[model samples]
Target: MRSEGLDLFAHGMIGLNQLKAGSLDSRNSLGAILGGGMDIQIWHGIYWRAFEADYVWAALHYSDVVSPSFPDLRRPYQNGVRLRTGLVFSYGEKKAAPMTAACSVQPTQVMVGEPVTATANVSNANPKHTLTYDWSSTGGKISGKGNTAAIDTNGVAGGDYTATAKISDPKTKHGGETSCSAKFTVKELPKNPPTLSLSANPTSVQTGGSVSLSGLSHQSGQRSGQWRQLDGECRHGFRKRQQRYAEYFRRPTRTDHRERKLF
Candidate 1:
């Protein structure tokens, strides 16, 4: 019974029983019953309460029967049997939540050459837990583990950034998460580019005749369409000559080596 009670204490509940029945006559009797006083630590609960049985041998038939000129054959005292058994069961519990979390970055505003920082504080802790840097609100970076961190702006600038953190416990399946942010601004430089001039003294000239050219040679624009003497080519001191034509020349089909004079 003590063992049964301890079993009930350690494992919850239990059903225990012991059988002892028979007479001191020729044949033994058999019987069993469900009885365990309140002494059992087994709590009252719904259970099948399995039964048990056992049998032992003893010499009573010849000794008792031979004594009183034939003992009562009806009572099979030692010839009968007794049985004992126990009942108990085990079950599972319910499902729990997982550890989840978020990390937040600080200073939602920033400029070129400024420092930024983020923190991973434990928002919740139960059963078991751990912390991790999941990501940032600005899609920037992640931290391995820790509570706080400082960011450098040496090579970063002019934009918004965010940081995220995840505190979790794979065991208890629960956690807390958060995020933070910052901003920055960078300065830019200006541009300045030169001018040019060109000139030819006269407007018209004969073909194949030499024309003096004058102008400023500067690196202001990318390229120059300075050929063929356009309308704007004579802006300065360049010179030009008059043109002349031939009289009584060869027919249209004839080719001549004579240079047409300019007027």
Candidate 2:
């Protein structure tokens, strides 16, 4: 038997048994088993004050003779109702959430006015749970959704920059979040190279005489260079000097004293 209500409940059970009579002594016989219990709804799906009672019949037998002096061949009747009651609980496992978040940037080094992409990797998150992402950066413009974002470096200054990703699981029990960052480097465009020019004051010089040699550097700042003279008609090595300003060199008086280009 059972009764249902908005806040209370009751239930019961009964066991049925049967057996055949035999010419010889046998143990199988008719019996009855009955049980009943009731519980109160203490909280949402949970119940308290649950109790149950069970009664079992154990005395039925057969006789081989009609004499009353013979001892009863079957066991004595068991007439006790066992009762039990306790508190009942209902619960479930806690929800998993995002514990740690990490991110990475592609092409970590780039020139000004370049582009980079960032991706996020989350840990300790439930596979079936939905997640949302928020992205930020210390330099450049950022656009993102879920676990991915883009960084535009147009008109951005040259230096190291960082991008961050914040991850959250909306269905988490604790409403926890994690954040991670990635770094990238940027450099300005290259500049034109330096240049050098050399000139000799006297186009021609007499044997055993010296000529004034000078040079200029297109690049600003202190400069140091080398000057060298080459022999012609039968190419041969000559004198060389290391200087910053004008340098005087005596013309060679040897047999190969012909005019030649100075480098």
Candidate 3:
């Protein structure tokens, strides 16, 4: 730190004649002081002023008389130095950074009995202190360890839910706790099985004749279907068109007066 400001100085002198008369003269002068210092911390709010030095300049006037017979007067500008070292006391308190947290979940939507992972990201936490995490949810059971946790979605109803995590620093009494929440959805299984249909072009075919076969499948939910032809000879001719709501399969068959079953 550094400082520069106006100062006041008082000067006094004692001469042989003044000593015999048991008297002295004093004068006050105005000056400017410039100085800087170094401080080392001894403890919280307490510091040791290692060293401080100041340069002072002032204008002084004086007069001398011997027995009132003759007199001499002079005016002069003087320079002075001052050094100091001591303990310094500081007041008030220091503020700490506020704690904050953010929560997120992997796979925001899941089917029942599937596991969901929740994570907590924290900021402004003390690295030296041990942190504790508390996990909770509106639905399902949540278990947490450190910053991450797992949620068991089994037996949970089909609806939207929230997972929350509370983070805290055990060493701090105040301003060291934070909480965050994330949302997720649970879906139930479909009530009915998917519907299937099959058709063939040219219902009757002669020997070695090719018949075009088409099949369709419909489902209520987001599900895909696969197609498999039972006939080994016609398996290579089967083509599948996959979709979330419906699926289509096409194949061309060659028959030779033998009965064939399609599934």
Candidate 4:
């Protein structure tokens, strides 16, 4: 396992002093140590401590001065440095799991000129590191950043295509990359023209009487209607009304006895 963090410790040390009479004495003192270091893995559960350096501070009291005639001769405070290195044995250290990515599209099917969105879901990723997302497609123009992208289906053929996303962590050196793919289809628009039908309520009308005419039109999966009146072989007074699926025309018959033709 590789590890690094702050260290807070209480340390004790013994100091030996030599007197002018060739005798030796010892003194004990306590101090606080604060530092940090890193360990690199050499094998399973075994690591080498690269380096550890700490700042040491302690106060050594030798004698007390009661008069201004004599100054203190002992060092009141002392600063020191400590360096160390060793091997570390760790137990039950857990390694990070491999990264995994899953891709999804908002619409599995769409018509030409429409847009589709692709998204990425990642697992076992390090939250402290920044992630990069790269996107590509077998068909259409795909563009995005981060976790989501937009696909332009304009001018693309009507068939199946794949959208893929690659996720990567720049901070990791190994097992930091993964990819996923999702399939989608594009459909072409209908090519047939709209169908229309026209009918009259009465084939023949008496002079000074009224007649009703209607028309219907159908296109694709929708229906719309529009109404208009035109002068034919016989002139007549007409009025129009619109409806959801049909159009109606109301006209007053004229006294002229000529044969009337409507188209």
Question: Cα-based RMSD of the predictions, in order?
Answer: 21.9, 15.6, 12.1, 10.4
Best by TM-score: 4
CA displacement after TM-score superposition, residue 178 of candidate 4 (Å): 1.0
Clashes of each: 60, 0, 0, 0
lDDT of 2 at 84: 78
- What shift in Å separates residue 25 of candidate 2 from its native position after superposition? 22
Better of 1 and 4 by TM-score: 4
Q: What is the lDDT of residue 113 in candidate 3?
A: 87
- Candidate 3 residues 1-263, lDDT tens each? 31111122333433221112235456555556676667776665677778877776765555453343333325556678989888888788464678899999998999898999999999988877789999999989999999999999999999999999999887766687999999999988666544566787887666566667755545444334454545544344444222321322233222222232333
lDDT values, one for every candidate: 0.39, 0.64, 0.68, 0.68
lDDT of 4 by residue, 123-195 (tens): 9988888999999999899998899999999999899999999899988766789999999999876554445
* Pairwise lDDT winner, candidates 1 and 3: 3
Error of 3 at 82 (Å): 22
RMSD of 3: 12.1
Q: Give every collision pair in model 3.
A: none
Error of 2 at 93 (Å): 7.4
- Per-candidate TM-scores read 0.31, 0.42, 0.54, 0.62
**Global CA lDDT of candidate 4, please?**
0.68
